[model samples]
Target chain A: MKAKIHVYLKPGVLDPQGAAVAGALHNMGYDEVASVRQGKLIELDLTGDDVEAARVRVDEMCAKLLSNPVIESYSIELE
Target chain B: MKAKIHVYLKPGVLDPQGAAVAGALHNMGYDEVASVRQGKLIELDLTGDDVEAARVRVDEMCAKLLSNPVIESYSIELE
Candidate 1:
């Protein structure tokens, strides 16, 4: 199975990297840009017989490894 | 108009950041994880009269500001 995972910082977490990228955009004449947030996309191939069980495992991965529980969240999709 | 933008490192780029995160995942018992790539999701509100024209402008923004053309790529969707 092929899946795409997204990990993002939760709202209220200070994202200095995102802020810096947004600032760069504005400075580069992208005045139409209102805001910029940075996240992660993990695309992977899984050798799994059951997608439901695999999803559970992937979620566990998110909780235990893929994201920082204190500041980040994640979502996954079977593609 | 509301739009969501995604910026990602181009294939073959050295993604040390992604490698670091993937290594962390493996260490945390996420053996199912095959790979990890980091990217950006930028959501914004645009004050535009024409969406078609706005899309072109946004593409320019991606090229000139939102992404580093040498190693990154971007996509945008009007929401």
Candidate 2:
């Protein structure tokens, strides 16, 4: 099974790295681009009974390791 | 309108940051975690008539700026 997980800073959280990237983009001349927030995408290949199991394991992984529960949130999509 | 963009390093591209995160996970006791790849997720609140045009601009932004086209790929999901 394969999956993609997206982890992001919660709304209202400060993301300096994201701000830096946005500044770079504007400097590169993409003026319409207003703000940027950077997050993480994790793709994994797993051996599982099916997508459900993969989803379960992935959810656990995200909760336990992939994200910081204090200030980040994550969602997963299976493919 | 709102959307999420995920940018990832192409397969076979080395991602030392991802490696570092994976190592952190392992140190924090996730032995099932073997390897990790880090990517970027950007969320935007936009002014647009529909998702399609937003998609176009977003794709262009990703291609020209958000990601390095030479060694990366990206996808977007709207909600």
Candidate 3:
């Protein structure tokens, strides 16, 4: 099984990298671009065939090490 | 309108970050985790309401700046 975790900065948090990207887009003539937010996607391949177990384990992974619970939020998709 | 771009390393490419994360997961007791791949997600808020135009512009952004075409692939979604 495989699990994918998407991590994003919580709403209301400042994202300097996103802001920089927006600025670059504007300078590149993409004035239509008003704002930007950047995030991360982590894909994990697991040995287990149990979908439920993989999801639970990945959820634990996210909470323990994959994300900063205070500033970021994560969602998981299992396949 | 908003556009999302998902940039990922092409298959067969080495991803040191992913490897490091996998190793960390293993050390943390997620031995079931066999492999990991990390990617990026970029969200753009735009002024125009034209979804099609936003998609096209973001596609160009990904191709020219957001992703390295040689070793990365990008997908864009607009809403």
Candidate 4:
């Protein structure tokens, strides 16, 4: 089984990297770009096939180590 | 309109960050996790509502700056 975790900065958190990207885009003549936000996608391949159990475990993984609860939020997808 | 780009390392490229995260997960008792790959998600808010044009521009962004074409690949999503 595989678990995909999408971790993103929470709304209202300042993202300097995203800002930098936006600025670079503008400089490159992409003036149509209004805003940018950057996040992370983590794909984990696991040993077990049990979807429910995998979700439970991966959720714990996200909470404990994959994301910073203070400023980032994460979603999980199982396959 | 909005565009989302998902950029990932090419399959043969080594990802140290992913390896570190996998090791951390193992240390945190997630022994079932076999492999991990980390990627980036970039969301762009654009001025035009034309999805096709937005896609074209964002794809150029990915090619020119957002991703390293030699070792990474990117997928674009318009919204």
TM-scores of all predicted structures:
0.81, 0.72, 0.96, 0.98
Predicted model with the maximum TM-score: 4
lDDT of 3 by residue, A1-79 (tens): 8788999999999999999998888889989988999999999988968888777788899999999999999999998
Clash count per candidate: 0, 0, 0, 0
Candidate closer to the true structure by DockQ (higher is better), 1 or 2: 1
Measured with C-alpha atoms, the lDDT of residue B53 in candidate 1 is 86
Q: Give the alpha-carbon lDDT of every model.
A: 0.79, 0.77, 0.92, 0.94
For candidate 3, give the lDDT of residue B66. Answer: 94
B29-77, model 4: which lDDT tens digit per residue? 9999999999999999899788887778888999999999999999998
Give the interface RMSD of candidate 2.
Answer: 2.8
Pick by TM-score: 2 or 3, better one: 3
Each model's fnat?
Answer: 0.65, 0.46, 0.94, 0.96
Name the candidate, 1 or 2, with the larger lDDT value: 1
Judged by DockQ cut-offs, the docking class of candidate 2 is: acceptable
Error of 3 at A2 (Å): 1.1
State how far residue B7 of model 2 sits from its true place (Å): 1.4
Please, what are the lDDT tens digits per residue for candidate 1 over residues A1-79?
8768888889999988778877877787777767667777776667766899888888887787767999998899986
Over A1-79, each residue of candidate 4 has an lDDT whose tens digit, in order, gives 8889999999999999999999999999999999999999999999978899888899999999999999999999998
Tens-place lDDT digits, model 3, residues B1-79: 8888899999999999999999999999889988999999999888978778777778889988899999999998888
TM-score of the second chain for every model: 0.92, 0.85, 0.95, 0.96
Candidate 1 - chain A - TM = 0.92
Encode model 1's per-residue lDDT on B1-79: one tens digit a residue: 8778888899999888778877877787766767767777777667766899888888887787677999998889986
